[model samples]
Target: MQESLRALLELQKTDQDLHELEQYKVDIPNQLETMETVQSEAETRLSDQESKVEDIEKNRRQHERDLQAAQEQVKKYQGQLYSVKTNKEYDALQAEIQAQKNRISELEDGILQLIDEAETEQETLETIRGETESLIERFGEERTTLESRLSAVDEDVAVKMDERKRMAMRVENQVLKVYDRIRRNLRGMTVVPIKKGACSGCFHVIPLQVVMQIRQGRRLVSCESCGRILITEEGLEY
Candidate 1:
């Protein structure tokens, strides 16, 4: 029975280590996933900025074409000025020429505004591109290390699991089942050493008779209040 208690105590320690390793495996992958998400978002922002620049360029080019057409109409109106006989006809041709010139002026102003907007958009696009590149570079080594750690965790867990199985085999079948049941119920230690004559798990005071039996280490004793298997602190020694 004392041998079984020692086996269970050792098994619980390995189980604790395995549990922590499993949690580490989960946490490291989440870190990797978060890094990937950040990089993807930066790239998406860069793409949207580039599209804004392209749209601005298209509008600017269209305004330039309209400005060219307006200038040509002004030339045609001035040529008609030489053929007009009446003053009214000449005045009308002059008014038409002025209207075409006004249109050209408006088009030029619109083109200038579009060009300024395009320049601003281009600057923003470049900024986003740089930010995206920096994020990739800054996180590159960290991402690689996290990936490597994830793979290493698999190997570590495998070795720990094998160790746990071997330790479990040393305990009696019924004792092992009770230990597993208590662990399932508590999600923590199944066997604990008595501390200050009380169950360390629930801090229940031990009866004198149970304390004596636990000291003998002749068989497993349980805390009356907590159902945790009890051992003297000395019993934990190899």
Candidate 2:
């Protein structure tokens, strides 16, 4: 009984190690996904800034065309002024020329404003492009490091699983089955020592008779509260 108990304890250690490795493996992909999300957001911001710059350039071009058309209208009105016969006709022609000039002035001001906006947007886009490139480089480095860590974790889990199998073979078939069932239900804690007259697995006080039997180490004793196999501190050290 003591030999089987000892084997089960050793098996539990290996199984716990394996469980931790498995959890680490599960978390690696989530870490990678978070890094990818950050990179994607940075790229999206840079793209939007570039699009803003392009739109400003298009608006500036349109303003330039409108200014040119207004200037041409002013030239046509000025030419018509000389052909006016009456004073009223002359005054109307002069007023038409002044109105076209005002339109040209407004278009010019709009073009200037567009030019300033385009310049500012271009500067912002360039800054964001630099930041995005840096972010990509940093994420690339982090991914490489994470991949290396994942490879190492995979190797460790494989080694621990092999060790667990070897340890499992040393225990009796029935005892191993019980241990497996308890471990599955209890999250890898199949064996626990009696600590302070209580079941260490659940911290529940044990009856004197149960503690005595666990100390004897002649038979298997399971905790009534947590259903885990119990051992004395001496049994653990033995």
Candidate 3:
């Protein structure tokens, strides 16, 4: 019984190591994707801000062109005033000049407003761009560090897996089968030692007879309350 109990304990250790490795394998890819998604979002936000800034700049230039054209029209009207021979023609020219002046004023006001808006937009975009760039840099560095640590952990897992494989070979097939069954039912922990007259796995008060049997390390025994395989105190680390 003691031999079987010892074998079961060893098997559980190997199984736990295997479970950890499998879990790590599943988690690493998810972590990498999460990091990449954050970086992508940051870039997209920056691109949107840049696009808005560009639109503002283009509109500002168009307004400037319109203002210039208005000024040219005023100049042409002034030149025409000197050539006007009739009062009616002179009045028409003056009215046209006045209309042009009003139009120029409107355009100038629009241009000024656009310039102010563009300045504000440019400043906002710069701030957003700077923040995005800083976050990108910080995330990149953190991701690189995380990747390095994950790589090291992966290597360690592989080493531990190899050790588990070696340990599994030492235990009997029957013991491994029972350990696997218990592990499936109880998640990863299949074997737990009796601690202070209680089952370590479930913390249930173990019967004296069961505890005595477990201490004897004779045939494998299970917790009557939780059905988890029970081990003796010596089964676990001292």
Best by TM-score: 2
- lDDT string, candidate 1, 1-238, tens digits: 8788878889999999988889988899889889989999998899888888998898889989998998999999899989999999999989998998999999899998998898888888888898899899988989888888888889999999999999999999999998888888885677888888788899999988988888777777877887899888666553
> In what order do the candidates fall by lDDT, top score first?
1, 2, 3
Residue 87, candidate 3: Cα error in Å is 4.3
- What's the C-alpha lDDT at position 229 in model 2? 92
Instruction: Summarize candidate 2's per-residue lDDT along 3-73 as a digit string, tens digits.
Output: 88888878888888888888888888899999999999999999899889988898889888888888888
Top model by lDDT, which number?
1
CA shift of 48, model 3, Å: 1.1
Residue 85 in candidate 1, Cα distance off native in Å: 3.1
Query: lDDT score, residue 12, model 2?
Result: 82
Looking at model 2, report the run of 10 residues with the lowest lDDT sum. Answer: 229-238
Each model's RMSD to truth, in Å? 3.3, 2.4, 3.1
What is each predicted model's overall lDDT from 0 to 1? 0.87, 0.87, 0.78
